[model samples]
Target: MTSTSARPRLAAGQTTDKDIASFLAHTEPVDALAQDGYLAGHDGRAIAQQLRRPGLVRALTFSVCHSARPDTDRFYQDDEEEAAQWRRRRTQTIRDHCAVCPVRAACAELALRDEDVHGVRGGLPEEKLALRLATDADRLGKARAADDRVERLRSVRLDAEREVHRVALMHTGGSVPAAKRAENNDEVRTAVQERDAAKKAHRTENGWTVAA
Candidate 1:
């Protein structure tokens, strides 16, 4: 039997920019950064989701110093550079909160899925790299686990291979044989490793650290 994921479902909506600006301006912040004079997660999503429905990302989000980053719209508290540096460190504060956050994966999927998320969002530049690296590492781990299972079932590899074949044929609307599965496994492993290596190269080019 197939099992369903219990994770919260993504919803569709068309929140507008005006609605967002009004939302932020009118509603008071309720998150940790509230005392520091900043909007929270939903606030960030409220603005992004106004343009895209899946814009609801829950990263450790907060504003930075007006001077340190140089593009900040306004000051967080004081005009001092020290205050800005304190604001800069707020990124780590968000990540520390994310360590305990229940929906970290869902939050990250939202950001990565969105192509326009530049600058600081949930965490700092490097902190976001860490989150994304952790995510990629997790997915790769699942793939590796599947590989390990096939290795351990060396004797009954045919049986497991047959199941995979049946499922693939059913999805592809074609015939397939477990007897031919051994060759297919080798091909799949090659393709996966190549793709993974390419991605790693790209990550390195951009200076984003990928996990092992």
Candidate 2:
């Protein structure tokens, strides 16, 4: 008896731009394929599912970025004079690699989903990607929500500091015992870090900073 795989087969000439886009719509972000963002123990199931989808295999099989430089940070350089040189190189990459890629549509869809935060994806640079996302109503709503969370976290941080101070003042020596002081300090530190993280998240939602 012969055993067969259950994966659906890709139809001939079915890897059109629309097909690629539709395939990516059902898949996760392709950040796992990036240079700086590669993780060792990523959820393989997602990738397996992507491969089993319509056009992902054909779209990425010979894509150019795969053979380009592994260090993707240059794609997100600041717009200084020095960075202009890198920008030119980035433009060349878009022209030479991304422009001719068969998966450009899929890559663009990923970028539109806010997946390609650090560099060029779908032939659009980080700046262009941010501008596009900024115009998206869904992205705007999420950014506003992030801003509110940052404000709330800031208030919690301030309250934590006051509590730390109050606890310290409860002692006649104008400070809590060593053990209690350490605990209070930890609480304040955690609160401050949480606020800072929230601020970072707000920046990410607005595309002001690269998501780590």
Candidate 3:
């Protein structure tokens, strides 16, 4: 039931200038978004120009995905048939919107560079984007490096969170009974001291030499 003319004319794993221009022409007018502060200091054309950059564009004021359903529905659900139905609908919606988007190339580029991105972008889903990366050697290498950096940052965040939780538990003396909260003895005192020491050490690591 779809029109052949509406399909994107992209080559395998490629987005040409012509393709970008064609889709960009279909993007929503930015005058209202700009007035509402979504565009901020940048004009629509300026934002469109940045779509060619390798980096993700922070200003997605004109992104078609904004009007679509949330990305979560694309995932498998308790009902297999229902989930498939949703996925098909979501994919079709993405294709329709992306085919006409002026920033489709940029949207796809962002999806390629960042592994954490989800849902439909650049008229394709994450799985399709992954396929594109897998088939391109240079792009695959770049994506691997980006994935490594993302994993490293995530590991650092998890470690910091765990340390914070440990310190909190130490300060609270490991969740003692309510009646025992007021009955602080040697064990509680030792825990408090350990918590304070840990806090001081953390501060020192961050260049806060002066003890509070």
Q: lDDT at 160 for candidate 2?
A: 60
Which residue pairs in candidate 3 have backbone atoms (N, alpha carbon, C) closer than 3 angstroms, thus clashing?
Answer: 23-101, 23-102, 24-102
Q: Which stretches of candidate 1 lie over 4 Å from their true place?
A: 1-84, 119-212
Best by TM-score: 3
Candidate 1 lDDT (Cα, 0 to 1): 0.39
What are the runs in model 3 whose C-alpha is more than 4 Å off? 1-55, 66-84, 140-212
Per-residue lDDT, model 2, residue 195, is 59
Mind giving the per-residue lDDT tens digits that candidate 3 earns over 1-212? 12455443445754655444323322322333223432222233334332322223533445555545345354423355676677777767665666655446556655565543366666667687778656654854654564455445545555655655655554365578766555444445555665566555443332222222
Per-residue lDDT of model 1, residues 1-212, tens digit only: 11235322223452665554433322322232223333334453343222211113222232232112333332132456485575655555555554334333334434544432444434334456456656566554553454344334442434444555554444232365665665666665655555555555443332222121
Clashes per model (N, Cα, C within 3 A): 1, 0, 3
TM-score on alpha carbons, each prediction: 0.23, 0.35, 0.35
Candidate 2, residue 2: CA error in Å? 24
lDDT of 2 at 131: 78
lDDT of 2: 0.49
- List the lowest-lDDT window of 10 residues for candidate 2: 36-45
Q: Distance (Å) between predicted and true CA of 27, model 1?
A: 37
How does candidate 3 score on lDDT? Answer: 0.48
